[model samples]
Target chain A: MKLKNEQEQKVKAGRYGKNFGGQYVPETLMTELEKVNKVFNELKDDAAFKAELHELLNNYANRPSLLYYAKNMTEDLGGAKIYLKREDLNHTGAHKINNVIGQVLLAKHLGKKRLICETGAGQHGVATATIATLMGMECEVFMGEEDTKRQRLNVYRMNLLGAKVKAVTTGSRVLKDAVNAALQDWASRSEDTFYVMGSAVGPAPFPEMVKHFQSVISKESKKQLQEQAGRLPDMVVACVGGGSNAIGSFAAYIQDPTVKLVGVEAAGKGVQTDKTAATIERGTVGIFHGMKSMFMQNEDGQINPVYSISAGLDYPGVGPEHAALAECNRAQYVGITDDEAVAAFDYIAKEEGIVAAIESCHAVAYVQKIAPTMAKDQIIICTLSGRGDKDVASIAKYKGVQIDE
Target chain B: MSNLAQIFKNQKVFIPFIVADDPDFETTVKNITALAKGGADIVELGIPFSDPVADGAVIQQADLRAFEAGVTTQTVFEIVAAARKETDVPLVFLTYLNIVFKYGYARFLKKCQQLGVSGLVIPDLPYENRDEIVPLAAKYDVDIIPLITPTSGQRIQKIAKAASGFIYVVSSVGITGERDSFFAGLSNLVAEIKEYTDVPTAIGFGIHTAQQAAEMAKIADGVIIGSAIVDIVAKEKTNAPQALEKYTQEICTALRTKVEQ
Candidate 1:
C-alpha cells in the first residue's frame, strides 16, 4: 500500500519528528557527523547493509527473541493487554547489541580502528566491548569509579571481553562524569577512534543514528503487536536515562499521533526532592556530553550531581531529542520515585514472574498507575528495556532481604 | 559605515591587537581607547577560551590573564558593546570556534551584529564551515575575516577569494609574541597572497619593534602588533592608557617612517 501524502512528506521533509535531530556540534565534529549521516542515509535501502546487519544479528546476537504476552499481569492491571518484546533474550542479554552492530559496522566503514564508550549501568559498555572484540577493533570504556564499584561484575565482564575499562573520578563521579572523560578522550584522539555513545544523546548524528539503530525494537514490536492484536497500542511507556531504550521504543511510533508516548524518569525521592536524576522535570537547558540539552545543573553551569538507586537512571541529563519532544508536547514526561519503582519491581515479579531491571521498573511503575484507569481495549506497551538479573543485589538490599543463591 | 571600517578605507589602515580584559578590565578599556587615539584604524579584541592550543606562550599568557580577570564570553561581548558606544573605531573580535558554537552560531552572530561589531576572526572556522556564516555575515553586515600565514600555498588564494574583508597574514606559523626581525619569507608570503586577490592584507604574529613594523609595512598593506603593546601595558603598574598611547604612537610613527622612506 502507498503511504499517505503527509506521511510521504514527513519522511521526505526529514523533520525527524521536530527540529530534534540535526548537526548541532563543534564545527570540526559537525563536518564528520554530516558525512556519516549522508552515508548512512544512502545505505539505508542498500541490500548489502541490511544483509550484513542481519548476518551479525543472527549469528552473533542470536536475533528473533520470542514475544511473550503477560496474561496474568494483563488481568491484574484490568485494562490494556501487555506484551514483552523479549530483547532480554539477546546474546548480551539486552537490546544494546542492535546498536553495537550498527556502530561497529559504521566504524569499519569510517576506517576507525578504535572504539570508545561511557556506561553507567555497564550494559552499554559491555555491549560495545563485545562488538569491538568481535570486530577486532581496540575498545575502551569509561565508567564512573562509583559505578565501577556498583556494577563490578559487568566491569569484570568487559575486562574479560578485552576492553580496557577506565574509571573516571572527576565531576559527580557518575555517568555524566564518565561521559566527560570519554568526550575528552575522543576530542584528543578523534582521528583514529570512534566514540560509540550508548544512548540517543550527544551532539547530532549520534542521537539520530543511535535512535535509528535501536528503532528495530519498535519496528519489531509493531509487527508483533499487529500479529497478536489487529491494532497498534494506544500508549507506549519507557524509562529515560540517556534515553536510548525510550528512543528505541518510541522512534517508530512518533509519527502516529494517536499513540501517547510517556517517558518515565527516575525521581530518586520525588521531583521536588533533592535526590533525583529527573532532568526534564528539574533541569534547565545546558551543554553536557557534547550536546545542548536539559540537565540538572548548578548556577555556575556545572552539572548538579544526581542520585537514583538504579545506576542506569542516575544521569544528570536526558537526550536532546527527548527534551525537544517534551517541548513540542508530542511526548509527556513522568517521574517515578525510587520507592515506587522498587515496589513496582516486586509487584511485577510476584504477580507476573517478571523481574525487571531497576531502570525498566520505572516504566513498570508508570504502567501500574496509568493502565488501571484506561479503557479495557486501550492497550499500553511498557518496554522491558532490560532484565533484572543485574539488579538482584540491589533488589535484595532494598527489601532488607538477602538472596542466598 | 563603522568608524573603524571608515578609517581603514580612508588611508593606510592601522590596527592593533590586544587581549580583552587583559591584566584587568580597567586596563583593557584604557588600552583600547589609547590605541584608537593613536591612529589605530580598528582594535582586534581577543576573547580567551580555556583551551587555546594554537597560541604561543605570550598571547596564551595574555589570554590566561584575561580569563583570570573574570572575563567570560558574555563579559567580552558586554565590554565590546560598551566600547562601541564610546569609540568610533569598529571592534573586530578574535576567538575560537568552541565559544561561538557553545553560544549558538545564529544567536552569537545576531548578538555581535546588535553590538555593532564590524568583523570576526575565528582561527578554527575552516573554508568548508563558511557556508552558514558567510550568508549570516552578509545579512548582519559583519565581515568574516580569514587568516593566512607565510606558509599559505594555493589554498591561500581560495581562502582570500572566500574572504569578505581583509586577510590577516600571520608573520609566522607560531603564535603572537615579540620578535626583533620581520623575516623576508613573510614579505614573500604576503606578495604571494596579494598576487591572487586585491583584498588588503594585515601582517601580524611575533612583530614587536618599530623596525619590524616598518619591515612588515614595506610588504603588507598594514602591520599588526599584539604581544609588544600588551606586554608594555601588562608591565606598567599605573597610567596604562598613557602607556598604550605612547607605544601605539611609536609603532604608528615607525610604520609611517617606512612609508616615507
Candidate 2:
C-alpha cells in the first residue's frame, strides 16, 4: 500500500482542517492560547530555552530510558522480537512527565504564576504536580470523581506534592469531564494560569506542542534500538487514550514507512458494545474540547461516556494528530478488550517481570497478538508508558481482591 | 431587515439567554415568551451541550438540568419554533460548535431560518475559523454573531468588520457568570470595537444584576444577562417563569433607564 509522506500529510492536516484538527475554541481563549503559542514558537528556537529543557530532561527527568529486550516474551510469542521502551522508568513513573516538564518550563518562561491541568488516571496529575512543586508554582489538578476513587493513591500523591486536587462530578465524571472542568477553570483564570494540557489533544499548538515534547521518546528509542537491536524496529506500539504516548512513540518513525505504527485502544467489552473507548476504531469526525478529532459521539455530536479497565484510556476522543494518522493510513489502530489487557498485564508480569500500567497493557496485549503473526527476525517496540504501581489497587479489585491501603 | 437588525436599530437592547428545556420544553417555551413580554429585544436560547467549556458552574448546571430533562437539538428547535408563533422576539441560539456541526451546519441554519431564528452565538467558533459555518449562515440569512474580548486587542477590528447582527463584547477575561466588576479596560475594548464597524456592540459575560446591566448599557448598544437568568430558572424550577419574567423586567427596566438618560 502506498503511504503519504509524513511531512506532506502534516501539511495537508493543518492546525484545524475538515477531517482532522482546528481551534474550535471561544474567542476569549484564542488570545490566551495564541500568547502561549507565541512564546512556545520562540522557545522552539531559543538556544537557552532548548538547553534548559535538555538539561532538565537529562538531569531531572532522567532521559535515555532503557530499551529492554523482552527475551522471554519474544520466545513465548515465537514470532517477532519484542523490545520495551521503558518510559515507566521516567520521573513520576510515566511518559506523562516528559510533556509536563516541557510545559512547566514554558509556563515559567511565559511568566505564568499558576499551573492547572486535568488527568484521568492521575499520571499526568502527579507529573504536573511534581514539576509544579519543583518550579514553586501554584498548582491545581482537576480529576473526575470516578477517577479520584479509582486512582486515590495518585490523588494523595498529588496532595503530598503540594497540588490541590479538585474532584469534578460533571458529565461522565471521567477524563473528558475533568478536561472540561480544567478548561472552564482556565477560561476564568487564563490571565494568570497556564493550563498544562495532559494529552496531545485540545486546540492548535497543544497537539503540536505535546507531540514535540513526547517525540523525545521516539527519538531516543530510534537511536537506542539501532544500538540495542542493530536496526529500526518493524513495528512501534503504544496505547491511545488521548494518544499522547502513542503519538510520542510514533512521531519519529511516522516518516519512515518501513516502520509500522500501531496504536491500541481500549475496547471495554467490545467495539460492538456500548462500553468502549476505542475512538479511532469506532468513531466519527467531530469537534470537542477545542479540536476537531475522531470522537466516540452520539449522532447528535454529544461525546459518549466511554468505559475501560484503565482510567487513563477511558476517553471518547483521541488526539487530532492520531485522527490524521489514522485517516492517512500511516498508522494502524486496534482495539483490545479489558480482559485482554488484564491478561496481558498478568502475563507480562510473570514472563517479563515488569508490572505494566493497565493502559500500557492494552498495547502489550496487541503486541502479544500481532507478534505471534510476524517473523522471528522482525522487531516490535512497545512503550511501557508508565509503571503499574498506580493500577495495582484497581487491578486487585478487578480480581475481587480487596487491598486495605 | 432581520429582526436582530431592527431590534438593534431603535434603542438599547436587552438580550436574555436561557438553556432551552432547562426544566422542560414547556417551561422553556413559557420562559422565552415571558422574556419577550418582559422587554427582551432578543432572546438567546441555549442548546444544551454535554460539554460547555466556555461556561461556568451556573450555566454548566443549567445545561445538565436540560440534558436530564431530555433536551435534544430537535427539541430546542421545536421550542424555538413554538415560541415564534407566540412572540416576534428575535431568537438567537447560544451553543457550542459541536452541537451545530452534529446537527449538520446547513440543516441547522436552515431550520433556524425556517423558524425565524435570527442569529447564532457559537462561543467555540472564533472569527478566524468561521468559514465552515459563516457562508451557510449567510445563505440562510441567520447572523453568525461574533464576540470580542478585552484580550482580542487588535483582532477586534478584523472581527468587528465581519461581524453581523451585533458583536458580543465579553465584559471580562472569563466564562459566563455574575461578577462584581468587569475588566477595567472594558470601556476601551468597546471603544476599540466601535472604531471598525457600526454593527451594534452588546456587552455580555458577568452581567447579573440590574445595576450591572444599567452600567454596561452606558457603554454599548445592549447588555446580555445569561447566568443570572439561568440561575433564576434553576432556583425556581417549574415555577421559574414568573421569577425569570420579574428578573428580566428588572434588568430591562435598568437598561431602559440608561437609554432614557
Best by DockQ: 2
In the range B1-261, model 1's lDDT, one tens digit per residue, is: 122334445455667888888877767777788889987877888887554434555676787688678777778787776676668676788876556655767878888788877788876565644664778777777888878754445467787876666788867543456766544687677777867787788888778887777877878778777877777767872467788788788888887766876
Query: For model 2, what is the alpha-carbon lDDT of residue B29?
Result: 91
Candidate 2, residues A1-405: lDDT per residue as tens digits? 334444555544345223577688888888888888888888976899889998989999899788899999999999999999999999899999999988988899889999999999999999999999999999999999999999999999999999999999888899999998898888878888999998999988898889989999999999999988689899999999999999999999987989999999999999889989999989988999888999998888877889998999999999998887787778899999999999999999999999989999999999999999999999999999999999998898898999887
TM per candidate comes to 0.70, 0.97
Give the TM-score of chain A, superposed on the true chain A, for all candidates in the order listed.
0.92, 0.97
Chain B TM-scores of the candidates:
0.92, 0.97
lDDT of 1 by residue, A14-75 (tens): 32333333333333343455556667777666799889988998888877665667788889
Candidate 1 residue runs with Cα over 4 Å from true position: A1-18, A273-275, A282-309, A315-317, A392-405, B1-261
Over 4 Å off in model 2, which ranges?
A1-18, B1-3
- Report the lDDT tens digits of candidate 2 across residue range B70-169: 8888888889888888898888999889889988999998999999988999999988788988988998999999999887876787899988889999
Residue A237 alpha-carbon offset, candidate 2, angstroms = 0.8
Worst 10 residues of 2 chain B by lDDT: B1-10
